[model samples]
Target: MNNQNVFYDELCLSIYTTNRYFHQLYQIVLGKYELTYLQYMVLLNIKQQGKSTLVVICRNLDLDTNTLTPVVKKLMIKNWIKREKSVTDGRSFELFLTNSAEQKFELIQIEIARIQEKLVGDDQQQFTKILSQTHTLNNRVQELIDELTNKK
Candidate 1:
């Protein structure tokens, strides 16, 4: 195989491994709260964005609606979030945190901070730099995917 192919394969493997490792850590930290990484991410995003639509959640999380639908349903059932039809947009519904979700948000934030501190410790500067670089790379990858899909 060509060097370019080898590089791409290695990069993909590294990304997958990193994601898996972090997910395992997240699972451990969030286990007591009965939340998965994706679920917590959805909550956090909604909390940050303040009354977001399903399309916004899907886009922010880089997940499809099918994958997010069940999670949102679960959250609604748990009384951690609520959904309501947008007054301006009849087709879209907005998501907002419930009282319980707001109460738990600070605890979740503390746990995540602890986990991050444990993992990165003194190397936080390097971790921040690497995370920034990863964001740039992810955007580039998305652009490439969009270009390829458009071509097809």
Candidate 2:
């Protein structure tokens, strides 16, 4: 195979492994909260974005509505999030965090920090570099996606 093909294969495998590891670690830390990694991601996004709609959440997460709807329902049932019809768009509902979600976010931050500390050990610099690289790569990937989608 060509070097580019080999590199692509390696990159794909690395991303798959990294995703699995992160999923396992998230489960270990947030299992008690009864939230999956995706669910936590949705919550975090809403917290950061103030108020969001289901379509926005799905777009931001690169998830389909079918996959996200059930998770939103679960969060709603737990009262961790509130959903209401958007005045601007009757078909879309706005999502917001409840007081319980705020409390949970605080706890999640502490627990995540502890887990991150343990995972990084003494390699704070390496961890920071990796995070920076990941963010850059994510942005690049999003740009690629936009280009491809625009073509369609």
Candidate 3:
């Protein structure tokens, strides 16, 4: 194989492997609360946004409504989140963390921090370097996606 193809394959493998590692770590930690990694992602987004519409959440998370709808419903059923009709947009609903979710958020955050600390152990510089490189790589991927999409 050519050098370029080898590099591309290695990059793909690294990304896939790292993603799985993170997912497993999240599952181990979040399973205690009966939350999956995706569920935690939704809750984190809602926590960051305070209150958000399904459309906004979908856009922010790069998820389609169909994929997120069940998760949102599950969160509601689990009493971690509550959904209400939007006053501005009657067609959509807004989501907010419930009091119970708020109470547990800190505990969840602590576990997340522990996971991150393990990954970043004794090497802040290395962690920052990887974080920056990942963001750059992600931007390039998006640009490539846009270019290919426009060609269609």
Best-fitting candidate, measured by TM-score? Answer: 3
Report the lDDT tens digits of candidate 2 across residue range 15-117: 8999999999989878999888988999988999989998899998889999999999999998889988889988878999998889988899899999988
lDDT of each: 0.90, 0.91, 0.91
lDDT of 2 at 151: 48
Candidate 2 local lDDT, residue 9: 95
Cα error, residue 77 of model 1, in Å, equals 1.3
State the displacement of the C-alpha of residue 46, model 1, in Å, after optimal TM-score superposition: 1.4
Q: Per-residue alpha-carbon lDDT of model 3 for 31-57, expressed as tens digits?
A: 999999889999999999999888888
Order of all candidates by TM-score, from best down to worst? 3, 1, 2
Model 3 alpha-carbon drift over 4 Å, by segment: none
Worst 10 residues of 3 by lDDT: 143-152
Q: Estimate the TM-score for candidate 1.
A: 0.84
> Of the pair 1 and 2, which is ahead by lDDT?
2
* Per-residue accuracy of model 1 over 1-152 as CA lDDT, tens digit each: 99999999999999999999989988887787888888899999899988999889999888999999999999888888899999999898999999888988778889889988888999989999999999999989988998989953
- Which pairs clash in model 2? none
Model 2: lDDT equals 0.91
Assess the local accuracy of residue 138 in candidate 1 as a C-alpha lDDT between 0 and 100.
Answer: 91
